[model samples]
Target: MAAGGERAKPAVQSRMENFRKVRTSEEESPLPFSDLPPDVVEMKVKEGSKIRNLMNYAMAQMELKGRRQIVFSGCGRAVTKTITCVEIMKRKLGGLHQVTKVRYKTLLEVWENQDPLPGGPAQNLTVHKNVPSICILLSRDPLDPNETGYQPPEPAAGLQAQPGEAAEDVSGSSSKGLKRPLPPPSEELLTKKLQVQGAGDPRGTGASDHQPDHHQ
Candidate 1:
């Protein structure tokens, strides 16, 4: 038992050391956008577009906040891709401190319904099944409302109608050669005219009636 316990100690210690090294490396060296895979970059671009749309939708609210907090929810590749995008955006914009504040929530702990257990496994969980991933960005500055509500200036009274151009009686014949086309007859009027024409056709009815007496 003593030998077995001693054998396990070194293995555990080695794992702890490796964990520390990984954590330190992650803190010291963040993954750059250029380091991201092509597929990841493509995904980021797609997700970034959605973030832009959301920012546009709540422009006023984002402006009021004075800082942007991005939340990326997804599993594995999705989370990593968005994180790359966020990091790139931060670096391109001159770091997080340049703005009032910048933050992110990607871990399951942040999105879980119940409080996370202490030292719980930190992993990215998928949300919004169809979407697979989502990203949002807030802005410090207020977006311009760009209100164009000004009423158009009313036309000058002189422009309304010149004294020489008095309203013409359109119903009467005009001096101008242009003639307005007359409206077409309605279905009811056309049907009545056809009936009247049929009644006036005496040969159609008279010839047929006179011939019928021969058969009798």
Candidate 2:
């Protein structure tokens, strides 16, 4: 029993050490949190605050799963991966993703019916005992359903460039000629578009004009 206990201590310490490694990188530019523009810094603070709050909820709450609420929860290196992956996913998916911060109690409620128990040492330590340090949610609806959001298809080179500007110097442009492209429409938009189409509204011609592009 003494030898086994001694073995376990090293593993636990190893895990904690791995966790610290995830927080810092040997080669990376330092973020200019202090010198950044106020608005940019404000946004960073907001995102950081959100991540911290979500982590707190996970630590106190128990049991996390994917899909039901798109949770990103784990500790140490796992936690770092969760955060990095979620941010990338959000940017790539654009408005298709939604995020929410939930507590561990909420997790247990869904996966284990409020019972916080396990059949083995690993399960016992991982599920109910070890606190989660992060939680991220991605939903199907990042944008409101009632709003009209249409993103025009990307323009071919030279197709939409200014009269004298070279295509290489051209910036991102959509078919709609708008400065900002709207996110893809939600299910509600399709339904509304169908309704208008049936009613013979001229505006319902194509997916592009079916919904108004309202920036949120």
For candidate 2, write residues 98-123 as lDDT tens digits: 33332232111111122223663321
Residue 27 of model 1: what lDDT? 13
Q: Which ten contiguous residues of candidate 1 have the minimum total lDDT?
A: 20-29
Q: For residues 17-123, what per-residue lDDT tens digits would candidate 1 score against the true structure?
A: 43311110011122221222232212223323465543343333324544343332333344554555445554343323211112232322113213333688643
Model 2 error, position 149 (Å): 24
Off by over 4 Å in 2: 1-69, 100-132, 142-216
| TM-scores of the candidates in the order shown | 0.19, 0.24
Misplaced by over 4 Å in model 1 are 1-64, 97-216
Each prediction's Cα lDDT score? 0.38, 0.40
Q: Pick the candidate with the highest TM-score.
A: 2
- Predicted model with the maximum lDDT: 2
TM-score, prediction 2: 0.24
